[model samples]
Target: MKGKEKIKVGITIGDLNGIGGEIILKTFEDNRMLDFCTPVIFASVKTISYLKKHFKFNLNFNGINTIDKIVHGKINVFNAWNEKYNIEFGKENLKSGELSIKSLKEAVKYLKSGDIDALVTAPINKHNIQSEEFKFPGHTDYLAQELEGNSLMFMVTDTLKVGLLTDHVPVNDVTKHISEKLIKNKLDIINLSLKQDFKVRKPKIAVLGINPHTGDNGVIGKEDDEILRPALSKIREKGMLVFGPYAADSFFGSNNYKNFDAIIASYHDQGLIPFKTLSFGNGVNFTAGLSKVRTSPDHGTAYEIAGKGEADENSFKQAVFTAIKIFKNRKEYKNLTKNPLKPKQKKI
Candidate 1:
């Protein structure tokens, strides 16, 4: 029951202008991909063909108009994007963004319907996608809305993991969003994700400060001592192991990040800047608190490197593997909780 033996991951091509198409095509380049699990891409045939032809990738694709005709050896594309894409690398426009959003919407349907086990999204341009059909700030919010409002964004790498209490918000608005209720809710989501999705029994997390030197015990800002500390104390009192309102400036450098399972940052850059600096190309952006397992590559639409075959598929591969891993963990955890005393069998 381990590995990718029983899972179906749905992939949504983010922005054709970025490295989304390139990495998707490159990821499926291996003929042995079928050995893992079935990959169902919710993307356009034309766009994928554009990537394959432009990048000179020779992978078999099962281009079908609907979901029923999916099979292996050829990738099953769900035809989420119908429009003929312009496919300009390093360019941002409404058309590409809308198309990316369209794929996301369709993929959600399959995920909710149990047609797909999880979702692996490629990178998208947040700026261009804010218009019209793209009403929400980004995929995290959009997925939250789709799931009826319960989703958290988590950036994960090998060495470090950081979850946001508030994401994609301006510096001014960040303080406004940090409340006791919001902090507790976000912490619950992180704790559940660590156990259910990440397969951790007990998760230890570090809560970061809103100011330098953790408010210097109120010399700088009272938010860390008054707001963050009380919140962390309440969370610890609830039996979850969490600590600090640690100094934002020195947290990444202290090697204390390794002590915790995840870091809960006050703002976007407070956590993401360090996460990105340490894990630029290999990080995975996972949507926790969702009914379905969802993960995406951490980097955004690199339009400058699009269609050049220079885009690395490692992150996309990581996203895919992470989805499969979560899917397995969900299945196994469910089994264990249901029947913990069932005889443990060693593979002999």
Candidate 2:
């Protein structure tokens, strides 16, 4: 429950064997979660029941069998399916993976139908969840394909935001994917998302080059001068506040990352390695360029600490809060565009 007037968010529980169920229980510990948005979760009643027994979370909840009858208490659950099975905590199994992915797909239906404002996904392990029923590398790619958005994978924390140009690719193949067009497309997604989705007035983006020492001006590699720098010029011409081809190794030192609103990296590790180092436990992964808002925790399913009541729920909490906040901002942004908002300050 998010709105005093109506529901605001639809949450999906990820793999049950992982800490998804535990975090969902812990993250919604605040009574204020109900006030921010109506949360319709796509999960199983059986899984929910199991967690309540182990965790002993005392909240008024409704296990809804169908979407039409969902009502809020402390939590509202819409069962994606009605199957019940015993699951071992801190362990990976194929059935739990299938259940998690099904829940995600079912949640997307509500998103597409406008039944929910935004979605906050709990952690799911990609390796375990890659069976025939669930073939996605992760939620970001799955949501991109489903929503048909030209999207970039953005890992956001309180202080830093990193957008990947080529995600889930090997280091050897990273340079091959770094091109003028690819960088522009990723930047376009990041820039537009900053405006319409996040309400950033003018976003300054930093682009990292593709090699160590930023290619050392062709001493190490020419990809920096030959490729990335040219892309920066084109992005600037479009009236965006973007810079860099910043050095790959030194960019994260001494608060240098705070200089820009967002950093667009040449590849996956180029961006994530540093970001995880800084905000590993607190980061949130936001999928940019989708029509609907979607965010997930930055870290994956921590199987080691899944069931001991030891998994920190901060990132999960952040993911949920980020979705709810962005939902309101996007609404305001849409309202501004629809009514063509008057300028707040007059020209001097």
Candidate 3:
């Protein structure tokens, strides 16, 4: 596809009981969004109609049963399922989980087949979404299994970017999960992502330590000294601009993160807490290093303000914009690297 063409963006309606509907409706309500890319929402027209009525949204959409029927410059609602969903605001419903998974699976199918250029998923209830078919922790794990390439949960904004070394792992198992291979692989992914996805020619990355004060040189813990430092040393030898087992406590507070292009956290909360604290309502959860582009709002199902129309759509809007930007960046990167120029040969 050419760089100027509008890409197809597949969207999943997350938990019906949460703020997914509200945010989606509020975002597309402005017609200007359709000018960038065509949005294909993986939900029934009936479902969206219900949401529109509840929120009194004045948006117009095209309903279709097949992918070929999508209309450009309009919101397309593809009916993934025919059954009517019972949306009880601010409540957990197993049926809502089933529907959310259904929407995700269908959207992923189109995403894999290249019918869609990128994907922007809504939030789902982690606990309720668990079932026989979908046993993974969240979108990152599920997409990692379905799509090619290693996956990294990258939380991003215009200025700040953070990737997770270990995501969805328990606090006790975080130390056990850290290894040299994992660190190098994640660094490679982030470095590549920065160049191709974010247009960074030379990316600088910072790695946060597992323990406080980076194990204080083994006084606090041995993992930082034994595992993290050695891995970083080997990585640096390979000519990648990677640095630090910096103390997680002081990394953000000291504003040291601003010096680097991206930061890698040892675990989930250590990265997310600081990320959301800094960029909440504007940050996007991007699944980096995958063959296909996928992004989501940084926040999850906000059940408390589900149907009150109080949910913020900034993160969701940013997710869409980020997905479209990455899609274009990848295309440009591929075109630039498809055929390399040869160096001048020395006189024979």
Candidate 4:
């Protein structure tokens, strides 16, 4: 679908010791998936071999010395690391963290170089992946810095789409990040992403309230009524179809989310909790407003079931499909906008 060629998706094996390898291998176990897109997993060949043996999986991957050697219809492993390291399943270690960052850096290099059409990242343990080299709270922040673009944590599924106004901040600190200007900027990012990435011509966005009961006209908290309402008004005045400071409690419960193209929540849990609850096994985490396309499984490293062969591959597979869908959508959007046609007028 990508210019008459299968899209090459570059994947980063999250924490080597986590369920990243298991999920990645399981996703590509069926050879038929290669027909949709070429997968290039950025991990050590030895790591994958070890996981295969440990899990008794029959997945096959083609190891390449360089990205140029990638086979057209094979699972390619771009061995980012060659050294022998201990991979303790279900345990967080410094070595696993280091390798995770190394794999991500390699994938990012190819992504920026246009070597891959999109990137699908495996889950990483945030605490273990922290190091002097990788010092962001999570993938969203790291990618924002590396790509030099503003990023929004947008969750996607066929049924619903959710974007967080404030991501990865503590509950106590979420309010500090909420401002009129910040809300408007985030809304603009979501709007642009809907049109450019998802191909929504005129996106209708729903903004959630921060306080309980939407601050009850300033009786509970002034931020929702004062900050969110004014911010949304300006965003709408700028010609974006945006609505709400709607109460978070009833928004999703009443199924009001189905009415809009995308929903914007004030904080992380306000949006993610509902989204994950509704679409945990099928949701895809899409990093919107990035120069390059990136998506990841909605769930994180399930270390408890890392080697048990119980981790679900549905989300990972959906991430791959979502990335491909978005990539194609963006391409078509570009083609449509490159030389837009004029509207016909009626005789006066």
Whose lDDT is greatest here?
3
Query: RMSD to the native, candidate 3?
Result: 2.3
Off by over 4 Å in 1: 1-6, 342-348
Winner by lDDT between candidate 4 and candidate 2: 4
Candidate 4 lDDT for residue 323: 97
Q: lDDT tens digits, residues 63-93, model 2?
A: 8877767664447888798878687888888
lDDT per model, in order? 0.84, 0.83, 0.94, 0.90
lDDT of 4 by residue, 1-348 (tens): 322358999999998878999899999997778889999999988988888898888778899878888877888899999998778888989888888999999999999999888999999989987877778888889899887688999999988899999999999998899999899789888999999888788899999999999999889989987788888888788888999989999999999999999999999999999999999699999999888899999988888988889989999999999999999999988888897887999989
Q: Any idea how many clashes model 1 has? A: 1
TM-score of 1: 0.93
Model 3 residue 302 CA deviation (Å) reads 0.7
Candidate 2, which segments miss by more than 4 Å at Cα? 1-3, 342-348
TM-score of each prediction: 0.93, 0.94, 0.96, 0.96
Candidate with the larger TM-score of 2 and 4:
4
Error of 3 at 125 (Å): 0.2
Range of the 10 consecutive residues with the lowest summed lDDT in candidate 1: 1-10
Off by over 4 Å in 4: 1-5, 343-348
Candidate 3: residue 315 lDDT (0-100): 96
